[model samples]
Target: MPGPPKSDATHKPPFETEELRQKLAEFLDMEVEVPGSKAKKKVGNFQFGIYAFFDYDKEPIYVGQTNEQIRTRIRRHLTNQRTDAVAMNVLDPFEVYQIEVWPLPELEGKDSKDAAAKKILNALEYQIFVKLREESSFKAVLNEKEPGKPDFEVEIPHSYKGIVVSDEVFAIRNHPDVRIARRASTLSRLAQIISERQVQRGLRNTLLTQATRLRALTERRLRGLEEKAKKQGAEPEE
Candidate 1:
């Protein structure tokens, strides 16, 4: 398999800001070396404060974030007695590897700390929550629709369409005769209602467009008349 494309450009971030520094600080505080390993001493300089995605049995799962050491966090996750034991079951100790570090903030105040951490985490490019199965994935389900129309109607739950006929208008139109006329009416009657409403809307939109044009023309004419009056040295009556 081909690896990712190689670019000639040297990789470097444009500039690091104060917020980034704070997140980096938190990141540096939480890394651990594999026990009884000769490389443990060498790994001490590694920082690990960010959230990471670890795969288990080749399936992408488990997301964790911590200001605490990564070794400690992984240990807790692997243990059965901890509060998040169910989450731990999915991860194999040998299979666990730090894929990426999601940065977090180091702040003094509680609210500020929480907000900063969230901000930095959100700034991460990947959808960490879904990749970790922390949130449900929004799959595009196939929808059935009437022929000749678009199949999918995007529905935003609880969004307001608009108020139909004003309360006063409905109240007056709700009278027996009006209701009877509308009820017994066939498709033609329904068509009449729709057509009339559409015609009214069209008329309104047309009038608005014409009014705008008229206003522009009127202003231009006024300016021309003013210029003419100025040349004749006559008082132009308003």
Candidate 2:
């Protein structure tokens, strides 16, 4: 009774939604400044995915994902890192920052229960960015968020104990001292002196301990012999 599912000749492809775009941008740490009114405005037929870069000068400091409201997340990174003293090292306080975003095709309908939603979104994000950019673009998914980026704390162990004057700064000051010290010191002879001291200390300790034990044993044996002689003298003449 249904005539081929009533195909519509006027049907058109739907556009991506701002919510999805904003969410993707937020996660990617992208700074796409979509207006609040625009983001608030609702569309029934569309949803979008986006990836973005939080760049410091030409270098990207962080990447993230968003579906809608990319501005919020991007601004958060910018403001928080600059204003907060603690995050300064991670964000590099002295560097200037910038942000850019990649928009992807909108996903349709309720995606809450969609089993393959993340995979689908990743594929879409990757495809859209690749199409839009000449250079490679990264798309970070929310569910599959990027791995924790490591921040190695480089330190000269000796620096904590003393000020690190430049090697060149102190070079002239140490030149005369170094020459005098090296002329006065002999490495092989110093080793011989150390060996001699160690051997002397060891021998002294060994002799002292042995002498103390011997004195105690000798005194004990003499007391025992004296006791035996006293007992013999006290006994009957048998």
Candidate 3:
């Protein structure tokens, strides 16, 4: 018998890459950030899977996995609303503005996914946790008790790596009105503490120094943004 004929169409994958990405984004409940906009609309309920939070600087701050809805777990980390973050003080919702998630629908079956799928997710989470820990870019993993070793050998695909959300999502949070509100809150707390003499004499200077540094950073960032916005309105260079 002759060798099989060249199949131009069948040789390619069943689905195109962009189509796959769109499908994956939909499945994972991922949102694309719209530049210079505060308005947001929910995509879909996040499925059970691994998730990670990034800071304003796009550095991994936390790594976690959930057998339940990923959305529920993530909501507890929001700044204004939190479950245990406020009580623990390890993670500040204000600092956690970006999020990337990997939704595993395969794990949702009442019978549970096969052992291999579970193993891959577990090992993937472990690998990501190790990467974040080694980088030490953010404060720390807030809830992970330990970096559990991967129970199974699995390689995280380049395309399937954990998401690092863009910083644009923070535009609304950093708006001038929000900044003033935050300043007022900070002032109120400082006034109460100082009035009650809660700060020790030895620690007062240290507290003041940190406060001043934080204020300076905030001002610098605001000025930088303002200048950039202004430059955007200027004539283009020849």
Candidate 4:
């Protein structure tokens, strides 16, 4: 007799892409202490906050704010191609290895369209944007639009940061050569898009930022290979 019939449900193999999605889901579900409160909330449930994306090198690559749910906005940007940034090729989700989110628990239950709340959100986004820019090696991010300048400022909130990619995935994507090639390809595509259509200055700015990133990664890869060659030449052969 044949063995028990296979289950009706399809057995989905754990591909690296699926592994990444699972890891990202876990990261977003993580609970953290809410600022100025004893309550803990999932980082992704916050309705108003700023979030930043970091590359394999831990370099800040993109920053965004969401008046909607953080989970929804981030998923659209990463898991799908709905976001303008993703559609325009301004940001490649493959490059996002880590995520940092600032959840404004205080803004919970507030109306999404409330003017005061929007101002605070804008201020917070601008603050994080400036801070990230200052900390970045290239002094730039891939945002096509600059954060609005609100008349007032808000204190930056406590942030929850974590890598969303699994170790197995990281090992493959973290190589400098791999990153350089990916960056170069993205740059080429973005340049082509700009060349083919009438575009805004922001798109041009993104192109420039991509170029800078590609150059930096290429230089780093070249240095690593040269160092390896020199070390090998210095070793005595048995």
Per-model lDDT? 0.35, 0.35, 0.52, 0.88
RMSD score of candidate 3 (Å): 18.1
The candidate that wins on lDDT is 4
Q: Return the top candidate by TM-score.
A: 4
lDDT for each residue of candidate 1 in 132-218, tens digit (9 for 90 to 100): 433312211001111122223321111001111333444554453443333233223333444555443433432333233334445
TM-scores of all predicted structures: 0.26, 0.27, 0.46, 0.91
If candidate 4 were superposed on the true structure by all CA atoms, what would the RMSD be?
4.0
Give the worst 10-residue stretch by lDDT in candidate 3: 158-167
- Candidate 4 residue 216 C-alpha distance from true site, Å: 1.0
lDDT by residue (tens digit), candidate 3, 37-90: 464323225344677776455656567776556656665555235554333333
lDDT for model 3 = 0.52
Name the TM-score of candidate 2: 0.27
40-124 per-residue lDDT for model 4 (tens digits): 8898999999999999888888999898999999998988759888888899999998999998888899999998888888899
Question: Candidate 3 — which pairs collide?
Answer: none
Name every residue pair that clashes in candidate 4: none
